[model samples]
Target: MFKSLLISALFVLSSQVIAATATNIAESAEQVSPLLPGLAVPNIELKDQYGKTVSLAERFKEKTTVLIVYRGGWCPYCSKQLANVQKIEKELADLGAQIIAVSPDSPEKLAESKITSPNYQLLSDDSLLLAQKLGLAFYLDDKTAKIYRNKLGVNFVSLEGEVKVALPVPAVFVIDTNGLVNFQYANPNYKVRLTEDLLLAAVKSVSEQ
Candidate 1:
């Protein structure tokens, strides 16, 4: 009888551990799931290029927002994307939309980006908090992190001094004045990006709606 009771207790403890592990995995997966259309944008505060605190939700309240999330200033692809977006900045303004780009680079680095445009806003997400809330954050494996640090000299240290190798999937989200995402595009492949035509179309659709 004593042996049976001990076995039963151990089984219950093991089951609880398994359940906890599953729950953790689920949460992690959810964090990486891209935010979809019709979802309310997360109202996270981030620092603008000048290091001023800015609320994303407040920006949405001002006008339709064309939000872009990129890897960092060090990434050439991100530079190209920013340049492409700059080409359409005038048209976006004509449609009454505001462009806001977020990246893991520090505020100082944002100013140094090759594709900096006066027409749009650049915000820093060095802590990756905003990306995580938007379901666009992903951790770099140890091997990749080592390559990025040693070979590329890309440090993942935040402004607050935390070191973590994480990056946001490049994404574009069009949020209306109501703070609702009318369209979103996210791709895990760093090389691929949404075309300017598609982005303009998405912004136009949101403006029309």
Candidate 2:
């Protein structure tokens, strides 16, 4: 366990070095990335935990949608954020909003995240197609990648592999039915995620339109 914790810390430090110029993202469970805000939200088609095809515009037809993208279930912070948002889902819906969470975790791993986050829709960005298209993907260097695998046992290979490519740093954006982003929450630090209260405010504000 100590080794794992150390590995996780080292992993975070590595991510920080890479995201230094843009945003300072970190590790998870309850960790939130500090990647700064971006300009737009692109159309993306990922999968649900059930391996069913999902498209943003289609699911959110004629309604407001919130896109909350994360690294994967590896972090504890993501779980907390997901659970919190789900708890206040009613508050969000009251403002005429729908929400979807995205991650690069394959359906199998995403299914594990879904087991913990059963309420919200978990979209799988297995190929990270949208992240790459949106310029949100970042490749992990060797030293850092080694820590995630040799130390933390992150298990990305079962889904993809360590030598794969970049993963999407955690990010959140609220998009209106028109498919334009109204608000965004991004950070490179994995420890910091947007609070549910703040997200609720964004929903309320946008719904007034």
Candidate 3:
């Protein structure tokens, strides 16, 4: 009986702690304007996997920009997100929108990402300058960093591999033609993502605005 009681108590306490952490993360997320409106998308040049220098900000012209930042092609969650985004491409285009995915992976990896699901364009943020400017990026913890290096074979060093670049929290944004983000979703955990319905709603709202 005592052992059972102890186990129950521990479970309750762990549940409370997890809930508290989630609440705190959510509250902090709301408080921090890592994303701001009215500010134009960061003007940075990134090369596509095909080695063409592409200006990110320039791509937003004449349409709403749906910017999706993912950790890498290695993440299955990112793959699902891309698949969902692709599913809504026609609708998004009808709403005068385009989707661009930016990541800290190499051009080769971006190519692989395209091969996996070829709908939207992918940009290589190998230098991570754009992520730094956007403030949605973070480096992996030591444990995960090692996992990425050894197990995942994600060679950030080989790409532009000098200083460690933080991975971009998977984020989705609906930016209007004016370059203002009308809606945004971000989370550190890769499993979670913005639903297509929510994103479509955002696009519709932005279009109306």
Clashing pairs in 3: 138-166, 157-161
Q: Give candidate 3 misplaced runs (Cα > 4 Å).
A: 1-33, 114-119, 155-165
Give lDDT tens digits, candidate 1, residues 1-209: 99999999999998876654331111222256877888998789999878999999899999999999998878889989988999899999999998999998888888776555555999998877778778887767677878888865554633223354667888999999999989998877789999999999999998787
TM-score of 3: 0.76
Q: Which is the leading candidate under lDDT?
A: 1
Candidate 3: tens digits of C-alpha lDDT, residues 33-86: 346655666678998888889887677766788998887787788888887888
Query: All candidates' lDDT scores?
Result: 0.80, 0.68, 0.71
Kindly report which residue stretches of model 1 are placed more than 4 angstroms away from their true locations once superposed: 1-31, 114-118, 151-164
Taking every candidate in turn, the Cα RMSD to the unseen true structure, in Å, is 7.0, 12.4, 14.1
